[model samples]
Target: MGRKVEEVVEVLVEPIANRNGLELVDIEYSKEGQDWILRVFIDKKEGVSLDDCQSVSRELSDILDKKDPIDKTYLLEVSSPGIDRPLKKDEDFIRFSGRKVDISTYAPINGEKKLNGELLGIDEGNIKLVVDGEELNIPREKVSQARLAVEF
Candidate 1:
């Protein structure tokens, strides 16, 4: 059910994001406590502004109202993915190469399930990372989640 909602919202939101000169990074539909939240993460080269989120929210709100895709009540949230953004697509892996990243695998790789290192990018169905001066090539399918690691 959640996956279906995400798919439906993605189809409805992509055009609006493109028209607004924004990249649709990800869409999430999940229950938090008693409420369902529909989160839309967007990005742009110049970075996303509050106005961008507001505009997308307004337009998307109207579209969702008319389309009425979801059967239950959910709060819609439109915002930037932020510095520690998720790395979802292959393009994201290439685009964020050389950046620090945190990755979790569905199963242990080298006896570790969580890895934090410099992203060496994706190559030939693998996600390459350099951890402690050692390069590790993790099969893309094994990665459960990957995101930029916040550095302070």
Candidate 2:
């Protein structure tokens, strides 16, 4: 059900983002406590502003109201993917190469499930990383989540 909602929202929102000169980073449909929340994450090369979020939210809200894709009520949220933004698509991996990242695998890789390192980018269906001067090649399918690592 959650996956279906995300798909529907993605379809509905992608065009709006593109029209607004923003990249649709990700769409999340999940239950938090007693409420279901639909989160839309957007980005742009110049970075996203509050105006960008508000405009996208207003447009999406109207469309969702008319489409009525979800059966139950849910809170709609539109925002920027912050400093530690998620790396969702293959393009993201390539684009963020050389940046610090945190990646989690569905199963252990080299006896570790969580890895934090410099992203060397994707190569041959694998995510390459440099950890402690050692390089590791993790199969892309094994990665459960990958996101930029916040460095202070």
- Across residues 11-43, which tens digit of lDDT does each residue of candidate 1 receive? 999999999999999999999999999999999
lDDT of 2 at 119: 97
- TM-scores, all candidates, are 0.97, 0.97
Candidate 2 segments exceeding 4 Å error: none
Clash pairs (backbone) in predicted model 1: none
lDDT of 2 by residue, 11-80 (tens): 9999999999999999999999999999999999999999999999999999999999999989999999
